[model samples]
Target: MVLQFTDVRNQSHIRCGLAPMEGVTCFATRLWFSLTSQPDFAMTPFLRVTKEYPWKRVSSMYAAEIFELKNAVSYKLIPQLMGTSPDDLERIATPLLSGAPFVDVNCGCPSPKVVGSRAGSGLLEDREVFAAFLEGLQQKLGHDKFSIKMRSGFLSESEFPALLDIASSIKMAQLTLHPRTRKDRYTGRANWDLIATASRECEFSVVGSGDIVDFNTLNTLKNFAPNVNTVIIGRGALRNPWIFEEIRSGKSVCISRNALLFSLATFALLHEFQAHNPLKLLELVKQGLFFTPCLTNENLWQALYSRLTTSFYGTEQPISHLCLDKPTFAKVKMIWHALRSGLGAQFMHPQLLRSRDFCEFEREFLNIAKDYNDLIPLKYHSEFDWIYSGEKRNEKQESE
Candidate 1:
């Protein structure tokens, strides 16, 4: 299975992977992806390189913290770097890939921020600069070890063959294509037709991304895009964490309510670990939209008010008071609304502070995160490290 990176392994062709999406795919989710689904290879979300501070701190500010974790779980964690200049790329690349293997260059991210900076799929418009970026990456990271992720092209599938030619010339370890032009974004159907064409055109293993959500969709793509080597999943992975397991074993997973709750609690626990500043904790918790996914459905306001302050707070009944209100995953509009309003943990699970037993491990663990440094730092270099350091500092200050 491509999911298993060992070259000589018995399993073959079974490559289940998670697509990298900004603000969504982080180490916590990466852990969930591998531990839960066991994808063949996971692509680190795009980390933009700027000339701001060289390799001093994180690029997007929030990007590097998630990418570089001390105990980065267990699995093949592939880091992706996106930059316009070879210098900026090398500047961050040195530290980003310090002890990492299999770095991937992103030419596929369609975010407006990415395109505005000319780092992601926008680079597809200029093949020369694009090739220059890859050649430089190859020179810095070596030829066979680095991979590249890209969309078909800017306008049409015409540029895909050229894109493959460039990837081939660099001897890229692998190529993952999200078969839509910059024009379509996520609106149009993924150009599986173009993916089929490029799979045959390229010598390297090609990974197909776009809309491989469920077991049926995964199976459909096996025949539909025979040319591609693996299937890459994005939003679907968030909506259904068991995607990899379902695809690999030829089984469909019924996402249970308990499953969603477990995911929510544990993810908050992980974010709380990395949290140094309260706002940071709140922000990362906000990203865990997939876990408690149901604020935007019907009766939005009622759900919001309930999730925030129920019998869990004030002169009211115990939160168990409204125990029956928390429905099994029916229509998740309420969860959706909360996520969009603010990616703040305070909003998503405001009652967490009130519950003595909501998530005990999280409560004790989050006690450490309660330090201001753990959330949004007043002045700290490594917010991730600050979580532990802040605890020590708080203790010292108290003793003093």
Candidate 2:
């Protein structure tokens, strides 16, 4: 049974969400997050709706998987769709809309591939078309059934007020603002001031995203923006699936090395059972290990890299054997680095490495966290001190 938006809002606590991420947040990962954490709602990664596309075609197989995820999570799981025009949405949204409890429009994807096609945040570039698209959606699926996920603007902050006006006119069930322009991508700090401003300007509930990876930030956001009652977490949840549980329970979260391995083992069993592909499952583990923030301990990177390369699921042979070609390893390293950097401004940017160095990085996985991996590492808060306290600092500097 799915909960309505009002039902979710009426809850006493601040609502937490697993944000929609294209490659990282899939059914398997969502299941892991739901079972391991306390997200009140979760969203499937954005589905690119195209006309007469084979991959977009809905199947019972896919529906059954969604059903299984629903059974596992036992909460609101919204399916998000992306398209350039209303025609694309009308053409390809049936299977998903029919199966989902509620639907979301994707207007905030910043990938060049998505933007080049004028589909994701690209829609925001053309205000007239975007407005018409929302109007058509309301006509097609009443006001209560859908929501919109968007960035502050396409290329500039100037576009947001106009965009917000159009979105509010439709009475969208909710509006989730990522608070960064497409130009910002995920490198800079998220503009929570814009989120707070939007909450004040618009009548609908506004959900904030970006740079919220721990309980402290969650608390800070709640106190900072009393109007912005919900937050959608992507990388934070991936790094520590127990984050939500810790936030809701208000307890310090400490994971022993064995407990962490045991949790991954359980996730591996479920992922393998569902995906039946060791290669894909291995990639997810690597992503989790790399994206999760770590303290600057001498052994932390070594332990993490080891876990990234070796098969932790206890398969007869290591997952490295499943890689069809040699070059895949290099691509994995580059991709993981980029993803980690994209989460916060302070993180080092990812760069391609020489093959030998890449192998060395892989081999460094000599030790997996021999010590416990605390989800709420002390420095996690310190890393983003600028974000939570920048306003006061700026005022002091001005006074000086």
Best by TM-score: 2
Name the lDDT of candidate 2.
0.61
- Determine the backbone clash count of candidate 2: 3
Q: What lDDT tens digits, residue by residue, belong to model 2 across residues 251-344?
A: 5455444333334433444344344554454354334432333322224433543453454434332322333233334333433343223223
- For residues 1-400, write the lDDT of model 1, one tens digit per residue: 1223532231335566677877556654564454445565566677777787445755333433334332333345567777777677776666655555556778887778789878789899888988888898778766555677889897777887887788777776778888888766765457677677767877777778886656667667778777665667875565455566656555554332233344444333333333324344334334542232331122332343344332123333222232221221111222222221122232234443334444442343345334433222111112122122224555445544
Report the poorest 10 consecutive residues by lDDT, candidate 1.
377-386
Which segments of model 2 are wrong by more than 4 Å?
1-12, 54-56, 59-69, 277-368, 371-400
Q: Estimated TM-score per prediction? A: 0.64, 0.70
